[model samples]
Target: MQIVDRLMTPSPDDADARRCPHDGTTLVSRISPLRSAVRRCPACLRSWSDVTTSATADPPARFHSFRLDVRPEPAAPSAAPPAPELSVVLPALNEAAALPLLISDIETALAGESYELVLVDDGSDDATWAVIRAVLAERPQWQAVRLSRRFGHQAALLAGLAAARGRAIISMDADGQHPTEQLPEMVRRWREGARVVQAVRASDARGGMLKALTSRGFYRAFSRLCEAPMRSGAADFRLLDRTVVETVLQASRTTPFLRGLIPWLGYETHHLTYEPRSRIAGRTKYSLRRMARLATDGMVSFSVAPLRLATLVGAAVGALALADLIYIVAVALWDGRAVPGWASTVGLVALLGAVQLFSIGLLGEYVGRTYLALLNRPPYVVAERIGDSSGPPPAGERRA
Candidate 1:
């Protein structure tokens, strides 16, 4: 832990005899263009810059170099703690005011169970990461991960799931709308051998009539198009067995749509319906734009029905045009004349053009997804990881 603080500007007479201040060992010097000369201790690997000998000059001039602040050696990594039976993952963003109560509720609900709480800060501009750090200081069993930036709610949840070291994992929101009281029941269902324990939102009193209608319509369309038994009002608040977690991580290497993907797995599942509570503090993070993005991810990732729909529409349009041509020919043949209208021709052309453009745009969406996948970008980047638990292994080791 010693630091070499003294200056070492060696002259031509004793250029090779400089010794390390910390260990009294000989220093190795490497000449460089910008740095003039770089000195490093072979034994300890500590580095220093020597600006006295410029490579471009025949007779190097002497100059003082700034000292770098000394840094302590990293502590040795300790053995990982025992794996918990259950891991609760919560992804938070700008919910600093709601965390303390949420943590307390989780603790009380899982009082007797061996569980660990993993809080993920999804690039919150607020003090969300600061609060997470305080929690980690007091609770050794807890874990916190801060992403490089906000990768959306699903990516944050996936990051937590990647770092969870439990036989079963439960994921929920940190905005306090998801009730922790239902946790025990979800655990009970897991104990009864259910691989997936879904917490379906029976009712959202906070959501107005328009939102309810849109939600219902989306689910119905999703179920019909994707052909998966995705329950209407099913939410991200759910418990997953270890196998399901691993499978999801492997399958969803790109963007993940958990609400749709989970049901598509067709695993043995147990559904529990509960009414959603209002946010404990602050406003809803999911704006209309984000909601639309999520809906697009769900539909695009799990189903190709949009492309099929385009084909079906094209076929229907072509059939109608063919019938109209037959009728026109029949009228002209029987009556020897036909009425012409500019407004009718213009309307038909415009309608057909709109349908063609819509079909092309739909095809482009699918192509864009493929292009992104081929690029193989990671879903999220972890800027910092803090915990006593060693979570999961690296992707390479896991594959091995």
Candidate 2:
């Protein structure tokens, strides 16, 4: 096995002669308008982009992998290139440090497969967008989209999905928590007729025992509350078939929690579990408040069980009050103990008042959601787009 490299710019023969490092198929070559070398493997569909200086005596590539050594026998090229087989969509926020290594991990994971990396910057205040541009210069298969402001995690994922043109789409985070090593199995499962391939976390050590229990509780509650039972530990790191993507786009959910919606969409779903990696970069963007809001969104948008629970509580309280009234009247007639006890009366009033406030607050949650949905506000707005929009819809058209 040997390492090899190709020139940034090549002669017609040199261009046609390039092959995929993962597999020994002579690559189909084309030059992009940006003067970048775009090469594709006809057999495995793995793609490459070269945009270094265009000198004839260009230096050989320093980057090489043991798994991606040059092939002994170069396979013949096909007549036409096929569409990308996979789209790795990552939603990023203030992830400047993690972007470089994560992208490399993605390439390594899908070395022989025809895939594109779609990175959606969810209004990062850091140099994340700048890093994306730099990386794009190095790899033509990379596509970056910048959102106007922080649209939260789910919206960013939606934006990337909307911009991805690949037949199979995989959504993950940029925080390195979602392992790229599992990508191969996901693609394999997708090809094997699984419309939705969900990645489940074996365990999370980031937040210790209490946080873990809380997360587990949320999933259990969500499963019971909603019609669709989301698999425990199911996460955003999952693959979606093209049809599944279309199905998701059809529903205008203002606060869509895809872990639930994907299952509810009624496709053949498969699950894979892997231990989540610890973050190597900045602190998590999800604060306590954000997590609570996200939890609320998942519950309220997907289930009516909360509203039902409130109603049941109201009825039960009413029944208890009626029984208490009957008991008091009987005591007054039989034992002449009808005098009101100040302490008990005060306690009863306080308890009843608390319940009333709780019920009102619960009702307000549903009402607010309904009112927002009726207003038809867009879940996200795109401030600036990073990549070319030749295939996927533009951000402007992706409103709501």
Candidate 3:
């Protein structure tokens, strides 16, 4: 791996020194978990690697060969330490092809840093669990959580965050929408006293004309109708302070629209606008139907405006009826006959009927959601968790 800092070059004289070129501190070298020539210092958070290219590289970037010491190490003493400085919570679903590579990118970005990686497998039908196991086998710094079933993205993310053991927790996508390179900026902002660092999308780079128009309308309507003001292009890729994380877990609603819910926390939020990259693997887990459901969740979870909308429609219909009555009275006094037309009457009845049905449906949606929430169901159920050799899984967990 190419390092920007003045890393020590391999030479007979320098090799004997075995010290960090930037600092006079002694450098400890060992075969990395990935069996790479990745020389790093835990104290300094500085690293560089010597790698041999293979078919894994597309069209061969370079070619060489090297060796790694793969001898089994001795057992460790039984002791536990403090939590990591940062924790990244990745909610994965059918992202086996992209998880390992994303893990690599995250490692590279946080090279030598004291951080934990929490990968949550949100009930993928594919070999995602196998990939998670393989990644855990490669490194003890990573933790993987698997749910019993698909509990949707927000729930999966909450599960990961609840399991996270970091001072500063980050939530991102496993399919590569949230870039790993900007992690430093997020940390910097967090250290600057912002409890939340929101990675706002620069643009909705996908969707057709109709989709775009509908999305715009949805946000506009949501902002005006709902008590919570959702930022346009706000994304779920974000960092939450440990206090906020704990607070969220304590609040523990059965359903949470995290994108809107995070903002509702009223924390000191810092905005970091970035253009999202396309996934390096399969299609998005969120289909159009799922998107609509998410939108509905956001709308209903934050406000009772849908119910108010029914009231508004009822009032507007009453106003129209009053206007019609006045017109009929005036027409009878002027010509001894009301304005002739069954057509107008049929049209008005149809319009009123449709509006009333739609209003009832909207009201029913809120009631139905409230009913489900009242049931007090668990947001998610954990199937298993791997990695974190330091200790057993948290309370009420199943081992795999």
Compare candidates 1 and 3 on TM-score and give the better one: 1
lDDT tens digits, residue span 1-400, model 2: 3334443434335544466676543433554332556654444657765444455544334322113335455566764444587889989999999988898898899899988889899999999989988888777655788888888899998888878879999999899989999999999999899999999988856678877888899989988888787877888989999999988877845747887889888899999999899785988888878888888888888878988888788788767766776677677779876776653475467657767987899889989988999999777877666555565555464421
Q: On residues 1-400, what C-alpha lDDT tens digit does candidate 1 reach at each position?
A: 5463434344435454355677663332544433545655445667754545345664334322334335476687986678899999999999999999999999999999999998999999999999999988998777888888999999999999988999999999998988999999999999999999999998755788777788888999999999888888898999999999999999987979999998999999999998888788999998878888888888988889988999899888877766776676677779856775543465567657877998999888899999999999999888788884454644432210
What TM value does model 2 have? 0.73
Model 2 lDDT-worst window of ten: 60-69
Judge candidate 3 at residue 105 and give its lDDT.
Answer: 88
Work out the TM-score per prediction: 0.75, 0.73, 0.74
Q: Each candidate's root-mean-square deviation in Å?
A: 13.9, 19.0, 21.5
lDDT of 3 by residue, 1-400 (tens): 3233223233333333255566554333432222346755533666655432344543221112222323344577876666899999999999989988898889898887789989898899999999888878877767888899999999999988888989999899998878888898999999999999988777775756666676777877877877556677776789999999998998867858887777777888999988788898998777789889889888888888778777888888878876776776677778766556753586578768877898878978878888998899889988898866346755677765
- Score residue 93 of candidate 2 by CA lDDT: 93
Candidate 1 off by > 4 Å:
1-79, 319-341, 389-400
Q: What are the Cα lDDT values of the candidates?
A: 0.82, 0.78, 0.77
* Weakest 10 consecutive residues of candidate 3 by summed lDDT: 58-67
Q: Score candidate 3 by lDDT.
A: 0.77
lDDT for 43 in candidate 3 is 39
Relative to the unseen true structure, what is the C-alpha lDDT of residue 317 in candidate 2, on a scale of 0 to 100?
77
**lDDT of candidate model 2 versus the reference:** 0.78
Q: Candidate 1 — which pairs collide?
A: none
